[model samples]
Target: MTKSLVGYGPIRQTRVGVSSSRGFDSESLGYHVGQTLGYGGERVYGRLDVDYDNKGGKFDSKGNRISPDVNQTDQQDTESLSVNGSLGVELTDSQRLDLAVTYYKDEQNTDYGPDYGDGLAVLFGAKPSLKAIDGANVENEPYTEKSSVNLSYSDDDFVGSGSSLNLTGYYRDEKGRFYPSGKTAGTQASEVWQANGLTDTATLKKLASAATFVTQSEADIEVMGLRAAMQTETEVAGKKTLLSYGADFERENSEQTYYGQDLNTFLASNGLTAQTNGLTYNGGPDTTIDKWGAFVNADMDITDKWHTSAGVRYQKLKSETDTFTPIYEQLLEEYFNSPAISGISAAYGIDYQAGDVEKGSTDHDKTLFNLGTSYQITPNDQVFANFSQGFTTADIQRALRDVRAGFVVNSDNVQPITTNNYEFGWQGKHGDTAARLSGFYNESDKVVRFTDDYTVEVVDTDERIYGVEGSLSHDISDKWQVGGSVAYTRGQYDKDGDWLELDAVRLTPLKGTAFAQYQFDEGSNIRLQALAIGGDDKAFKDQQKDPDASALPVTGYMTLDVLGQVKMPVGRVDYGVYNLLNKDYLTVYHQTTYGDLNRLPASGTTYGLSYTVDY
Candidate 1:
């Protein structure tokens, strides 16, 4: 339908401009340039924006390595380019259409690992760096990129007189990959083995020499979707009313690949590829999902004091996957067939009973509903209550991979979870002050737990959570303003009927922020802000995998900062002194996700300045 409507032709440019900025940061130098173009004739009008940014190195919060090598630090770094555009066409007096497109690429060093502030600062515990490796050159380079296009059409006659119909279709292709991770057979192998219950260093070296073990992953995703909506505006029984209905369909396919690092020199100097195909396996799975849903809603003036709306949706989703696991038997086959000494059974005496394995799939569907109503107390005040349902499938790939080697992976073996959420809140504004308060609770038969491996581990247990949040802002004078927000939350899981506090990873700590702002002029302003986070001790020797896993209690801390903007004669400048008080601290992600071995300090006080000009 879109092919027949929009014609391909040269765009007539109307306006164009470019802006650039130079930034100075605590650890590095950076800059970015942005350009925009406006084009169209009478029927077609649109604008395009493009930008390129070269961020500085050591940009990550903990990027300052604990014990860094000459060039083996800055785990968190990025460089990128992006483009976005939207166009509209007036097909007729009563019909119109719009199109939007987006694209971005993170030109980053994908396989470069993050600094844990501990190890010898090497790659995969084996290689010195990516520059030293000759194998998996393309495979070792992980990256992120995506492109998408969307089309929307609306017409009054699409449905009937007085009824309007809207149609939208979109397609997107995206790919993202992360760095390689594993216990390298290099210098750190001895320490890693000790942690995993191996003592004899010689035997550890001998076994590690025999094969390469690590985990790396990436996903190539493609999506195509379509949705149609129709609405009519008319008077119903002398009351102003509106009714709308819509249905949507979408199909997504993601080809997931997970494999170990390709170590080129494990056997000897410039030795054979130790991480051979027989010794390797894709720990990730290819997945496809087909989904379709429909919903209807009605809203009416009903009265000037009250407004109400209710909607219900019936959705069906089917998830299918090509599950996988390490096929060790393939190692035996490669051993006899290829020149590489691939078989682990002969040299290692390790049990390879997981032969002739079979893969499985996951299937789920649900019907969801929702309702909401709001009452206007005054011109600037309102209160609302709402309830809703949500459904999703957990990380089937991780669950499938964790299956016992001898068992099969199916819906019966690798089950997914369904979740429900409930929320209510109030918001109002009076005079020069505004405020909001909210409470939320959610539960599920099984919860999706995130792990440091960058994978979701679905725990087959009943989990419940409840929390509340509040925010307030006030203008003390024409030149002064103040505001703040506070939140508190807790969660627990059913463990054999003895409910236990959730891990710090799943639990939200008590946190709050306050700020004060002053205006020097209409175009210049400055602000000061502060943040505080409370600690947690739930998983500290309390959970099943206790006493030293993610068992470390989270630590609390507070910090203050100053940020401001001033209009200059040539352009505008933005500056900030983050962590102004130099309240030295570490990231909460560290304590809640990793053990003491990964104890790394967060960034100290840092400063930033940037200037921009529009032309």
Candidate 2:
């Protein structure tokens, strides 16, 4: 068995009217164990793990608003325990088979001030209004139970030529539960507010008090998948060649049960009726999805100094709903006036049907391809280039719902977002030094993005991102090594077009990292590293309103980290500190919600220690 202890702390200082603080006293404990057993040509491996952690610190809230306490505490505690075992068998000298099964249960609880919920509410408008709710004590409890089985087989005697066949399969079941505190419930109200535009904040406040406060609910999901592949090696045109083919299938089913005073009961107690205020009660629905695909690839060497590879894949996806819960329609008629609700209705194109509604299942199919080549430029240098195409299917989230509801139109039957990528790169080595450089360009069609109201939509316009990245490393002596990497990227929408979310924030245009490490004898080592990120200032709707805001000027920042280690008879101990310079900056923005980049304050310095051993 192995055991460990961990701790972290943060200190913050605001230079420009932003919230900041300083403190520590956070920690965690973890333990794990593993063993092996053997019988003839078969081997079995088993392992167990347990862990607990708690974090406490303070920082600014939304929009750079400083908190009142210099030492506010936000704590998260988690406990996870799992056990797994696997068996491997040697069917022959050149063939093998393996099978594994695992069962895991994890429970986590988080308690923090209103900052957590408030931040989410402000950005997505997805929560109940805090103005009408009490937040002195707020907590979120989420837990998951999961079990899985895995199997694999491999064989290598196909017709005497070097060839192999492999097969793998997996099945998993997951059950989860979530509890919403008063603060979380309030966030739900915010979501409704943005969806319906019923700006009666006071009415929402009152509804907040009477709403069905779900202290807890249960969500369950099950998934199964299988993959099989074959590969062969042969001589072609006096050069070695490899060919591979594969197929895969996957399926998932999910159900969510809401437990609490049903919506009708709560509304009746509050002297409300479906007709009295246009209120309606709808529950959660059950969902199911099925996906399957097949693919093939080939690699051939035309000459000793040149090689090429190619691949293609085809996939199909289908989704359907077993039931419909009209929570949205109920809330709209009850609280929002008919006109306001109608506008939203027209925007999303939702049509209400009285009887059991079966949303027609959606079907999608796609194909992807790739090609690549490599050449040796010199004895110590090589160059390569590749072009590839890829796609990802959409999910049943708010975006998809809006697409189905007719609030938005994608015109492509919600086809998968597709990307074509091209890259050329080189690598070389010179004695004790090594270097690599690459440039890449990616073009995406049917780009999907979220709208200001949290609805999903696909833009007809295209998007392009191109960049260059390079890295180098050198060994100055037997005891010391140094390395660095730099990258520059440019991303933009096509000319004369704009994407609500992408247009409002800046992606990291330039980023670089440098590091140095020294080995002081065999027992000790030390290392230091630094990172810099830069981006052009971004402009948002709110910032655009301010003539003096300078269109959200581009921001730049840097951070540093240091680490040390000492070897012991049983294990090695490691210590490290991160964000040594504590630079404050915002790393991302969700323009659809908050209308500005959520500023991520510089994390204060944190130090921790860990130990590892090999039997």
Candidate 3:
């Protein structure tokens, strides 16, 4: 919401608001302002915004809390700032140049209490006993800064009559730091005690008094790109047609640095030579990616009621990764030479041989195509069908790290994934009513799957997924309106044997939302909404073939919410109550790398109020 300053014409607009919700110790504040200046054939605009958030922790079903428990600070707090500016110049009648720039910074400090492990034990039936400790304090502080600038030039008749050309160039940089406290130290203690089969209370207490494990890390990313596009109107067999094409190239650089401890070597240096050995993580790595893409499409009227379009895109990607050898490898070699540890490793089929950092490069090239047709039954209604192919590389971050026991690369060969998608839909509007229905079928090859294991491994496989979605809305009168929407999805893995329901891939098969609203004569309105999420338990139980391997099912839940606004002379009052009924449900449920179940519970009831003025 915004309000204009008096006597400033269209040059000044300002906005401000305050919001409060349950579980937070303090309210949030936001402010924004924009200004514009215009002269002969030129205009410039700029905007500045700031947001401050004070996050209050949440409560579980038992009324226990898991918020920051630090001694002196707001456990979960965030501050963000954004600035944007644009300049436009009318070089000539049909030619123009525009330049824009944006900068954003987000900084957050978060703390966690001890009760964090309660839900994990109860819901997942497994505990990170080594990592979760009583009286242990956990904190995460991350700061991100980003900025971008773009320049564009356009000409209406550069390529002849009824033709236009546009070109753009841009560059962006993002830098951040990821620092965690207390977590690594706690886990190290747990692993050491377990590996040594130690249960003596006095010994355990003495070990706990040792130094905590901590790491310092930093990340930097940079991107630069350029694009050019042209559009023209022409006649194809006497039918007017539009042809559009574009080409783009981008380069990105990513780097990460980490500093940590080596448990075995550190303890041995302190006269504790008999202590069990455990590896640690430490290093700095970098990856560079270059991508090039080009696409062309044609839109033409086949008949009075029918239209068709065809397009194809050619994409090429090249990536190179470089890693530094960490301290863990050296420690592993030492352990291998010791007779005591060597026997244990040999019995377990363990290989302590470490390889040098796998510095290498990979490339991917693909040509994707799209075809579609639409038929207009009336001026306000239409039905369309589309088929398309797409290609995407695996997660870059995942490619850089191995969660395997030795933190080794899981595989030496990596490949891109491809998807084939088919879709059809119908959309129509009649009077005060509107509706839509759509269905889609998609198959993907070489999809990445992370197995539920302590040391995670990335696997590739084929899969098919299909879904349908629909929505309808109608206005009963000038003062009342109602609308609702629903979606359903199903998926299967293309295994060597019989196809199985994609167990590793968690998807809620059915979900829906409905709402009703009342509008007053003076631009004021209130809305009530209901949302339903279907349980995955029933579907899993029926589809799972192996009883021993099946996981706990996800339960279904429904919630209610309300939103309203009141119009005043110079401003509007806005408010909302989320989860009005305080429904208890899990928003997400899945297995973690350690084979432990993980769940994120939905928030309890929360309310917020804010005001905006247009002065």
Candidate 4:
């Protein structure tokens, strides 16, 4: 069982103004403004169960069934609306100006019930059908809309001693649409039970009696963006200096059209319908992308306790495509006359065409760097260090088509997806007590993976993480005050490998938080809180049967919360409670094939209250 429904609405506005001129005599001006609006929605339903056990039959085949049970249902809907505005002006005492605008619209609807099949028909024991391998009934709808704008200007002299200057600009737009619902035989009997793994049920009733579900299609998308920036600050040698620079440009163009029936003329108008179950569509044309960038940064204070910063960045990218279709020139002559894909096309000896890989274009360039340092040691202590670099790009639907013309085998390299970061830190304060600590290291390259029906694969592998973040605060007298924070992480996947099944383990190793507050002299306050998160024990990928006891081990739990506040006269009043201990935890796991992974369950003990006013 599956179900979902959600909605949203928002609006905001702001304005501010001020002016002054001194000479033992002053002229003053002031203005301020604000506005806000909001809305909300949510609904969900769930259920699923799959059980199988056959030990000692040494793997039985033929519609393979030992203990089978399957059932399915799903639903989804989403909505959104937005608006924002801002303006600020002060042209005398030091010059200032600002303007902002934002608009957005969103709508979504999804309905897929019929127990959406295809995990090899729930692993070989088929039954429970919604019919569609051309027997018709499946649906889809997608939508999107967006808008943005911003502008700014600033200047301050204040006797030309601690100068300042600033400038900013921005723009954005987006539109999208998609609708699908024709081509059934239950979606080709769930893609021939996920590409040939259909353990016979009379070959799934002779491929669901020669299926043919075709009748829904439409798509459209658009995107645009722009940005500009500049900033400066001074007070040189005496200590305190800052400088920033920027330049940016972007362009994207896309067009797609693929309507009802044309997958090889509906598989030659339904004639040799099951040579491994038909209809595998592919498309890519009318596409364009462009990008440009520049950046620089600096922050200095050489001595008097030392401080430094540096940065650099540059980027350029281009892509293009359009042309080639006739069902991709007859699947590129049946993948160059098969032979198990022409021996991987003579062992990757290039030139494997579908129109010699038509409509071509490619270009890329990148550069990034940064450095930092800080030290004080006394006057409350301080220390810091940093280094960074990151980049990402590649994948325009397999870079403009041609994955060995559909039998797969093409390595026309185009790499990008890099990162290198390091950090060290310390901070302290006494007399009410305050503190901070940090440690980090990250190195990643390439890394991109998605299969199980969503192609795209790339792995260079390299990951190592080290963590230690801390926070502490105290003031246990005169109305009390206390705080706490803790973090610890250890992630690994540093070479020497073989672990793919959407690998990305370690998501949050150890986390902690604690809080307390009390005040009885002013209005009123009382609060208490606690939190903890953890992860460890993960590994899965065997493709069937004891690949050494099929891994699955996850166990860790903790939760608690409480709050209260009061200050009435028509203004402050709040209350809250959560978890408190009604535990039956499970925080997420879903890899479905009825390997049944859906458990983020834990919600009990809830309460809320609120009120505010001051005019």
Which candidate should be chosen as best, given lDDT against the real structure?
1
Query: Residue by residue across 420-448, what tens digits does model 4's lDDT show?
Result: 88989898888888889888887676555
Residue range 201-248, candidate 2, lDDT tens digits: 776665444332322346678899999999988776767778899899
Stretches of model 2 off by over 4 angstroms after superposition = 1-22, 26-75, 82-84, 100-106, 115-140, 144-147, 158-162, 173-221, 254-287, 333-358, 402-412, 494-509, 538-554, 582-602
Q: Rank the candidates by lDDT, best first.
A: 1, 3, 2, 4
1 against 2, candidate with superior lDDT: 1
TM-score of 1: 0.79
Better of 1 and 3 by lDDT: 1
Write down the worst ten-residue block by lDDT for model 1: 13-22
lDDT of each: 0.62, 0.55, 0.61, 0.49
Highest-scoring model, TM-score = 1
Q: Which regions in candidate 3 have their CA more than 4 angstroms from the true location?
A: 1-11, 23-42, 50-54, 59-64, 67-75, 114-140, 176-218, 261-285, 324-354, 403-412, 454-458, 503-508, 538-552, 589-600
| Model 3 lDDT per residue over 1-615, tens place | 111221223333344544434544332222333333322222332333333334444453333343332211222345666666666666676777777788887665433322224322321233433221223222335567899999999898884575999999999999875533222222334344446565677755544434233343557889999999999888888888899999999998887654443434323232111122233343434777788999998899999999999999999988776654533343344444446445644654555554456566778889999999999999999999999998777756444454222333322465677899999999999999999999999998764554423222234668788999999999999999999999988877654554667542455558899999999999999999999977765435644563323434556678999999999887788888888887767553422112332343445776767666653
**Against the hidden reference, what TM-scores do the models get?**
0.79, 0.71, 0.77, 0.26
Ranking by TM-score: 1, 3, 2, 4
Model 3 lDDT, full chain set: 0.61
- Over 1-615, each residue of candidate 1 has an lDDT whose tens digit, in order, gives 132334443432222222211123432555566766665556777778788776544332433423211121233335778898888888886698899999998744422233322232332243332221222223444457899999999998764587899999999999876554433323332443455466686776664444343445567889999999998777777877788899999988877665544444322323212242324555545667777899888777778978877778887767676645542333323332333433433344333233433555556567787777788878887887777777766655545543434466566655656667777888998899999999999888886665443345666789899899999999999989999999999887776676767766777689999999999875889999999998777656466542222335789988888899888786677777777765657667755653333444555556666666654
